[model samples]
Target: MAALTIFWDDLSVETALDFCEYLVRSEDYKLRDLAIWIQGSGGPIDELDGSIGSLVALWSWFKSFREQGLPGVPLGARAAYSVITGRPLDSPLEEGSRLVGESVAHYVFKVILSLDPTAHWAVRAKSGRIAHAWDNTPGISMDGGKHFGPAVGFFTNYPDRLSSNYHNAYAAREAWDDTGLLQSVELLYLAGLPSRPRSTSTTESILSPLLRDDHVGSGHREEIPIAQEMPASITNNGPVSAGAEELIFASVGADVSRLDQAAPLDELAVASVLAELGFVSADGQSVSAVTLLSHGVQVQNVDGFALVETHVAGGRLRGLFLEPMRPSEKEWKSITDAFSALGEKLPAHLANER
Candidate 1:
């Protein structure tokens, strides 16, 4: 399976590195000393150790953000209203900045920075911090996609891959930090940028003598490279490439260890497995092309992913069908094992699929 791609607002690499430092310190204070030792800041600001996983993730995110052509966007005025009302209509403004809703998200906790301010989707501040804040929504659109809300869009009008990336990142973090929630994030500003050489007389940094003076210049801007095809190796890339000899390997998150076990299977067999797994029923529409259902399930290519229903205990259950993506040569066993593993870790959401 392909590595999940997330669109991020392209910013200076210096800023990205700064953010990396913040990620390091936030995740492990011990690393703060290591960063200082390595002269990550060229001097000690706080305090550190040797680990650096969070820093690497942030740095990788910066590189991938440009590769994937992602941009940061803030939510609109009426999106929160629409999410709550279940209507397509925009909400009316109230008192300018506060969109009086219970349990609305804290803007800072957003996967991306919150840049817009609308009363309809406004969230209250923590107590004693002044409840409401307002600002203008800087409108930016690409290929006609919503900037925020329940259905925020991603990449060249792609179905929100950022959401998947966010989920995967969250899972990765959960795998890493088993203690509790890690908050109070630090962000890096774009401090150094590489510039094109103007003359041979240019100098270098004292910290890293190999570094170019132009790269650390006062005004530096360079076009970030694009890497849209990076996911081809692991992505089904539209089961369009399917042939009698080809097998689609559907993958969830960063786990693709089972992909080598792939083998081709027809639509009927795939559908039957889903049915047996309780993801779909025999009466449901026949599997063909990718089709989104009102029930939040989608049948796509030879490999598909969906949010399916599973009853747990006396109530109901909803879990991500990561199991479906793990197809193998032993087709029947793969299907059964997929569903069985899923049953072992069924998620607890009983509400209608999102």
Candidate 2:
């Protein structure tokens, strides 16, 4: 009753990301073997049995893994995060952990860029949604939840992973089956091919609903009646190692009077206030109510904060939202303070001596 030994090393928790990178680079030689193992072994990795018939098919799988973030990724990403940062994937990821995550993502992006300059068709087709969400241009409305890039998603998590079966499958096999060849092939796949930008329509379809009036709290939808008091904060920045930056955009709604005490700040007034706060209109023009309604006035500062001033329910509700793209703690606090100051200066809070 000796423990069984396997020929190929199983993609384990510690090596998941590295193994995926191996798989991607060495698909020609390794993927076929993996397919054989999955098909013949009748084991847990079989969910992907018919999926890896060719390199193109494999790329599609990677594409889905990146875009959808299949279930098994969190633990794998957690494991990778620990290995990369030398820290446990604990809750309340501090600034150091956040930067490590960004560094990993930036490295992955650099890897994708280093690819062979010719992208696979599947990669090209899926390129529209590949950019990090935080890379959005000011004034443009697009999905901010898309943190996955071509190969970065694989680093975050491995997919179709069944825990027990992986251990059993590896123990059952008995050959040395080195991954040297696979590693070379994976390197070629990742570094040899670069993606081309896709059509604008593909991007438009994925725009954020938060920026779309027709989607939520719109005329047809039940209005989220303006609250009498502003909530201290509403943030989606969770503890996940990666994708946190993209989630940095926080929506805070408040009721404050204008500093002028003349009228509530309109889009133009908002733009002017933003200018004072060091944010420039995305298009270098005064924002009109029509433009604000269409695409919230996207103002970006050199300091990594983006603000989108929006009104919902046909102007009955005003919003003060902050989208910080990789801000330091001090920068975040500064941005929030600016928001508070902006709130006090607009309309009712301003005291006027008449």
lDDT of each: 0.26, 0.33
Model 2 lDDT per residue over 1-354, tens place: 111111112122333334234324432322233233223333233222221122232333433433343322233343222333244334422222222232223323323323322322121111221222223211101132222232333331222221232345344433322232123234223332323422212222111222333543323311112223212232234222222232111122322332122223455555555566566445544444455444244556644334444433344324434555544455555556665565565542221112
Q: Which candidate number maximizes TM-score?
A: 2
lDDT, model 1: 0.26
Name the weakest run of 10 consecutive residues (lDDT summed) in model 2. Answer: 1-10
lDDT per residue as tens, model 1, 1-354: 222211222222333334323322232222222232234423321211111112232323323332433222113432322222232223232211112110011211122222111212211112221111111121122222323322221111121123453454445443322122222121111111112212221122122321334432323222223322212213333332221121222323312233223222233333445555444322345432122112234432222333332211112111223323422334334444654454344311111112
TM-score of each: 0.20, 0.35
- Residue 95's lDDT in candidate 1: 10
RMSD values, in order shown: 21.2, 20.8
